[model samples]
Target: MNPEEIGLEKPGRAYFAPDDLNDPALTRLIFRLGLPAVAGLSINAVHHTINMVFVGMIGAHEIAAITVVLPILMMIGAIGEGLGVGVATAIGRALGSNSPQRANVTASTFMVLAVPMGIALTAGILVFRRELLGLFGASEAIMPLAEHYLIIVAFSVTLTMLQILSDFIAISEGNTRFSMWTLLGCFALNIILDPIMIFGFGFGLAGAAMATILSQIAAIAAYALYFRKRIGTLHLSARFAAFRADILKPVLSIGLPTTLTSMLSSISFAVLFTYAGFYRGDAGIAGVGIALRVLTLGMLPVIGLSLGGQAVLSFAWGAGKTPRLLAASNLLLLLTSAFCVAYGLGAVLLRYPIAAIFTDDLEIARIAALTIVVTHIPFIFFGMRQILVVLLQAQGRARLAATISIAQNGYFLLPLLFVLPHFLGFEGLLASLFLAPALTALLSAVILFTTLRQLRGDTDLPIATFTNTVSERAS
Candidate 1:
């Protein structure tokens, strides 16, 4: 089918062909596709940073409360993010094959699946709100504040999930600009509403939660409008959205592993927070939380590029464009490594100032700056590892991706977490965070080397090999 038939605009720069993807100047392609996602995810990073800043305005205790709540939110949101990755892969693969019908079907099906999953998540959080917060080390003083914030945010879980799903759909279609704009609009609204709700209405933490929820609602509306206008041909009927074993089977194959990977990361953070609370009380939690937010600001470009690369890799893999895949892979590694190293250096130099932005307390700022320096020492390696994991997932190596995630973030990190602290005390615990990724990067390099060897060999690589392996496993 033609681009017109798929409701895609003619001459739109959003869509990329296998030939364009295979071009020697693939760096240009990477930049083109990745920049918007970078902008989008970066703004999100800034939004979270602002959240900490505003919350810090209240008190270190308030910041600590939100710090405890962050991982729980990530754990809940992982469901949608993980599943959206699968949906994006499926759509990218279908588009690569020039099958608009299949792409539309996959998108519609995911939209259907998001609803019940979101509802279940909301209900689960409502039911286990206290337990969830407590598990992350919300002390008696922090617990009430966290609970109040969570109760308001809980109602918007569905909106957040749906927005994630829509963003993935846009990304799959090579249109992250739409998603970026949507996020920017939402962040603007949140920025405006944050102070008004918090001080004007005297809501405190609950006000922040309300502003976030409203922002997500606005984002969802933006996505809806964009899809209605740009993706007009997509079928959203029950017939397409209905359960089909064929559609879900492969989607779940890719999605479940990603979900597990994200869940493991969440669990790792939860473990860190738990130990931090034990060692340094609320200050430890706030310090680590602020540091991670700052680190994420540096890492957002890597994440954005990796995400953009996933879509390209999925499409290229689906089309069986090995050369393009290799080219893209090289560019991804080079750019992510360089950007992260530079960003990490800047973070080190500016850590104190960055920390001070979040909190005026000298103790909290010092702790936060210390965490940033220690954790960012291995930032480049972690960035490389992250890109590789996303590439593996996009190339349909879900099990491998998930295995690496658990191995690095869970096994290595958790063990080091408990062991390292014995030698260096709390500093060792901070060291454990970066140390795991550094060691894991070595393991990732070996696996990545093996994959690259296969990609460069005479025999065909990409989807054919993946499909054969899947078939073998199924049989």
Candidate 2:
């Protein structure tokens, strides 16, 4: 069948081939798919950094308050992200299996589940705002500011969840351009409004929160409209209310690991910050905060690339196109590793300038600069680990994915933090943070190679059958 006959148009003169891993035309196709997914994810990291840039101007206290609250927000948002990843992967697989009804069911189920959970999360945050902030090591001085920020953000949880779900839907349907536009537009709006609300209206920390919520609301609207018109067939059905265990099982399987991975990082940061506070006081926490924000700015785009790899590899796996899947995985590793190496070197070299943009205080900037140089040097392997995890999840190997998740967060990071500080002191703590992720990357590589070898032996599966199933389901 012609590409047009299957609802896919050739980008150029070359005809489409499912197994064309080495085709120049196919490489371009993968690039086209990967770039927008990268952009979509990067927009999220951009919003966080931009928010930090504005909040940093207010003072260290404001920065600390935001920092303390960030993990909680991420923990809460992890629920949505975890679920969204599951939905995206499942939808892609269903599309590959030529089960359009099942794909729609997956999409609809995500929406139904996300809304009530978001509402409950919002209410929980509002009711326990003070208590939650206290657990994160918030001081009396920072408590009020954190409370203000948390309340505003909590109320907008539904909008954020909706936007995330919509983005997943777009990516699953291979309409990443639409997802990218939604994120970019929201990011631009957030940037434009942050100054006005924070400085012009003197909203302080609350202003930043307001800007974030408003931007998310706009994104939600845009995504909703776009998905209804141009993306997948995600019509709501009464069956979604029935709560099919079979449908939700895969989502939860994938989502739980993803959530734990994020939560573990949040826990690690919280512990690290608390330790820094005990040993170094507010200055140390503020310094670490600045360093983290800088690191995020550098690492987020690589994460974007890894996410792109996840989407492509997951779809390819679902389609049983082992060659294409391997190609996509290797391409991501090569490209992202190169990017990380350059970024790590540049961060070390230009540490001062990057730190200075956040604050004028020479002491904080110096500490931040030093920390950035130390922490990011090991991130060269971080992207590879992330890509492998995504690949495993796409293939529905939840056990392996969960094990890697635990290894990265629980097994490696938590233990390192406890043990390293005993002998090395503060330096040990810092070293542990870097070492954990680097080790996680190495372990992930081993697992990926082993898994690929096993898949190679499974000779009964036919790639064309898989591809046809996906195409039929997607349509």
Best model per TM-score = 1
The whole-model lDDT of each prediction reads 0.80, 0.76
TM-score of 1: 0.91
Clashing pairs in 1: none
lDDT of 2 by residue, 282-335 (tens): 767777888887677767777666665566666666666666777677787777
RMSD of 2: 4.7
Model 1 misses residue 118 by how many Å?
A: 1.0
Q: Which parts of model 1 have CA positions greater than 4 angstroms off?
A: 1-25, 232-235, 422-424, 458-475
Please give me the total number of clashing residue pairs in predicted model 1.
0
Q: What is the per-residue lDDT of model 1 for residues 345-441, given as tens digits with 9 covering 90 to 100? A: 8899999988888888887788899999887878867667877787787677878887776776777887887788878878888889878878888
> Residue 397 deviation, candidate 2, in Å?
0.6
**TM-score, per-candidate, Cα-based:** 0.91, 0.89
